[model samples]
Target: MADLTIRNLTITPLELVSVERFQGEKKRTGNVVSNVTGAITGFINATDFSAHHILPKGDSHDSRDVSFHLDPFRTVRTDVRSADPAGREVLRLTFRAGDRRYETDVPSPSRKSSVMKRIDGDDDVDDALDLTVVYVPTGAFLAIFSSAKLYAWMKQLDDAWPLPLLSIPGTHNSPTCHTALPSVRCQSVGVPEQLQNGVRFLDIRVSVNTDNDTLALVHSVFPVSLTSIKYFSDMVDDIYRFLDANPSETVLMSIKREGAGRGTDQHLSRYLKAGFVDKNADRWWTEPRIPTLGQARGRIIIVRRFGLDEEMARSCWDGRGWGIDGQHWPDNCEDGTCEGGHIRVQDFYDVTESQNIEKKIDYSRGQLERSAEREFHVIGPEHDHNPDPALLPIFVNFLSGSNFFNATCWPERIAAKVNPAIVEYLCIRHGEDGKGPNQLKVGAASTGIVVTDWVGANGDWDLIRCIVGWNARLQLP
Candidate 1:
């Protein structure tokens, strides 16, 4: 099979624009007054049609101004019968010239008529008609919200900042997982569920105006973790291959950890140094610090007798050790030679807990006491300079397991720090009027384009989608 490339698909891609609409307002008529005075007041104060200036002949109109010319497009209606009563039998076509009056009847005067069109070829009307008239008013034109235009404009912006494509879901080791669609000719990582589902989503809309002559690319990565050594190496190869295929456009990769015990900055540095990440790549710092509180919370007690991970580490490495699925802890007491090697499991639990335990048993009490007090203390602080401050509280909170502390909050905190550029706000769907606030979305002031918030799980697919959407919107060449 041929190798996939990310560049071929982005060349001269489709650009989208949006259009919006609103219901017209009803006009009011006074029932109190009768004839001339009321008619004069209503005619002069009418809001439907108002007077605007008509430039003199030979005067050039500004395209940016309200009086610019528009092509005459044909409009067809079934019948004019059930229309307004003001012009009951008449289509009351009103035209404005430079302060000239031309009124006439029509057996369907099906000729080209604009705000400048006047009744019959009268000399006075013709003289006034010589000047320019604005066909569509600025107010009415501004009121229209075109979804098509919005989509188109967004597509233009997306051309530069393309969104990532999503993939179908699958089951892996009893967990649900989703992946990113493969680039046409670039390598892609097989992100596991543990690494993928930690991203954030916001409900927002973006608009961009890219009529200017500039090509720009916007990109971001959704970080995923890899436990297996093979998967990690494979992911690195895919990223390097992706960068190789797209030398022209900019790309960003967002890296996130699945959870504690997954890995750390050292792991990422090793991957990047191994030439997995492109040297020319732009890196956006997110979730800069991760705490080790989960695995180290009760280390003070667990290690006071037997060191934590070291012991587990030794057990896992020792051929004859049978405890902890052969996993090794960080302490050396499992060999029975260290200073704390003589401490009993009962003493260990007593020292770790807030209160003293009075119950004693003969069967599995020793093992139970050891396991009870240790409770994954490997997740806590090891030294003075821990980067992730949030880790300690999370680990301490786990000891209580109260409903007050949020489980999702920790993941969110980690996710937030992953991408420093991500605007801090919740993207929410609109109720009632179906229009959402701008608070959740990011837009460029120069292009007025709304940033795309990949509407899926906070996983690799969503992250890649966000980047691809940005590429498409920005029209990055």
Candidate 2:
């Protein structure tokens, strides 16, 4: 466990767009995506390479299977040693792989003489030390082109449960009214179940206005705020069992999230300590960075309001970490910059005079609520027994956008199974290509996209506590 495990790097079709080209070869001029066949070679001259072996090659079919053996090809362990520099036992490792052909030297423990020089003969030390250096590769290659784990991981992500709903307390004067809304489900990219043992789940918040019929309905599918991470952690064992039973096959693990305007509501410091900081925390199968209940405990800021005027928008932009570049505009606004980006609004809604509708709103005088507060209820498979609670939020956030179409009622449709009539309605609406129940997609063969405006006025709006996605990437492996 101490040695570095060379996890296979995965490449998506999207990742290849920038790294290759085809003029008149098997890949036509129009096809930029390449299979990218290559080999990896690793070299280690310091230690004995005779004890190692190569991992078995995968089968021809089912590229997803990776049909290789799990037996670690190599292992390294720490051993005790005398005369070490740090007065601590030194480390020695035995590298083993398929056919004992893959072995290399690792950093050894400091000699006691070195340590004595520094400490002036302060303490005695052990005689010998050995460390475990494990290897999982098949060939001598280093620049591997395999993405089996990536796809496998994505598939697991697609199968988890959706985000839980936020129960907003109602006032005596204004009672809370509850309604079952549609739920969103995340899709897994595809990965074998066996490799999902240490994967982590996460939940994020998003927001949408009432006017956005499709988006609202989609966002409405699940409550964005106030989810319990305990539920997801509870199901980890079951997931592992499922994967263990199915060795070579890939499966998806879908999870839901609160969309549009909602945010997280967890004990920030405690959650972070458990998922992000604890050195001994059990996170073998967890996602890299866990979004804690602490960051978005109260108000889940999914979106913000910014004035349509370029100047006002600029002012709002300046305040955000993403608005540094003006040339890239919305999509490229990683730090509020306009460099190398495209606005999502361009794909779904029209950008009128610089107004990003998701942020600003103008309420019809009579329809305005006393406040921006409301209650929502989300329904899906229940999970409440896992150690990592931060995953629920992260899973929900990503699942909200998994579908390619606007008919985001997939979760509700599945839940409606408990209610015969609702199931019928869902089938009737989404059954065929634009021939299902929700007349929304029944007439076309396109990815359903739903969007509408709730607030009328356009201006710069800022959703409080926006954690840039880039920041999250830094902490990931």
Candidate 3:
């Protein structure tokens, strides 16, 4: 076991099978990795690329059965340093099964160097076990991820699970975060990074420049960046790209009309329809009712905070009502409900001072408890594990709060306190990072959609990881 192995990735019991390597008509099928589990389990012979006798074209076989990338495609490995004719010691792995073929480097050249850390001469002490159901796009093998293993939590979930019941991580002012003003900027990462890290909900506020019908992202009255203005389409494009790549995942985008522009809520609605929604209609689900995972995959579930323009309401959404209407949602609501009562929130943002941060933390924990308590018991054998949608409410708990003068109560400052606190609370409440302990008492609890700010603060996405970890409750047999 000197190189890549499946045991290094997961504890799941895998059936042993032959791993074949091939190119064109030239095919070789044998136990490449000497171990028991179907994937590249046990130990893979990490050797120089030239020894493998690859084709002159460098193109390999397409393993029709369970296709994945081959190791040592065209780059040198940081770990393996050897001298070939090209002076590169690349570990090349070519796997072929049935009529299919796939091959790439073990530490994929396409992936960043951070993923390379996992392969240090067969030390499997890593986060592969933490993954709910992680898979690498570069390898598509198992739960072993390169960067952050949370790229796809929803993929493990049952497609029939309704949107309201799933435990989803989200960001407040997602796109606005670029590290500028503390009062306005609410996040550190852009929309794409947030989605890639398993954030499924996005809190968005847009300013409509009615003068030119252009949209700019805003947090309260201040622009996200002090030097430049970030536009609304920029955020939309980020979401578009993320969904395009990870179609198995979905985003519940909460769009509201607010900012330092002359744009009205009416103008905001029309612009979204004419500019983005209408053009790429397939990318969005505009209906008000909650959707099952099957229906929302590869699409954006619009949580419209503004009502549609009067005329479009009758013509659009197939008269199905426009988005999950949260238009009447009042400000700073504590365990508040929208007009239709489809949404429940705990957005107590009035933290005038730093000491009140504890109060804010308490409010957030209360909401998570409420959301978990209601849905946990019903999903047992009594409900056939398919609880009624009516019994489930969409819980939106905000760990975001701020103050103008209080330096400690600023957005980033507040997240420092709130984010870590919630992570600690959930771990204890849920117990030992697995479903068995909590599931026994509460039948697999859920925290619903949790919104926060300043994620990835010092490479710590624990809060997001914890929020996503709760989805294990829904993944039970």
Give one digit per residue, the lDDT tens place, for model 2 in 301-362.
22111212233334433533211121222431111212222111211112232232221121
Over 1-477, each residue of candidate 3 has an lDDT whose tens digit, in order, gives 132232112222222122323222222233455223323211121111111222222443332233233231111112222112221223333333222222334332222112222222335453232222121222122222122357777877677677777778989988866656667777777888888888999998888867666888788787878888888887788888888888888889999888778878888888888888889999998877788888999899889899778887887768757888888886897689887877899999989998899989888877787677654333554344455563356999999998978777788778877876776566444422223323333434678899998886434576787677666555444
> TM-score for model 1?
0.22
Q: Model 3: runs farther than 4 Å from truth?
A: 1-148, 376-391, 431-443
* lDDT value, residue 225 of candidate 1: 16
Per-model C-alpha RMSD: 27.4, 25.5, 14.6
- List the candidates' TM-scores in order: 0.22, 0.20, 0.67
Best by lDDT: 3
Q: Over all chains combined, what TM-score does candidate 2 have?
A: 0.20
lDDT of 1 at 244: 44
- What is the Å distance of residue 87 in model 3 from its true position? 43
lDDT of 1 by residue, 1-477 (tens): 111101111222211111111122233333434444545633432211212212122222211111221111111121112211222221222222234432221111211112223444556432342211111111111000111211112222222111111011111111111221111101122322212322111111111112321111111122121221123334334433533442222212222223223333334333332332234233211111221222211111011111123333344325322111111212312111222121121111111211211111111122221221211111223323323323211000000000113322222222222211111111111110121222223221011111121212211232222222222212221
Scanning candidate 1 in windows of ten residues, the lowest lDDT window is: 393-402
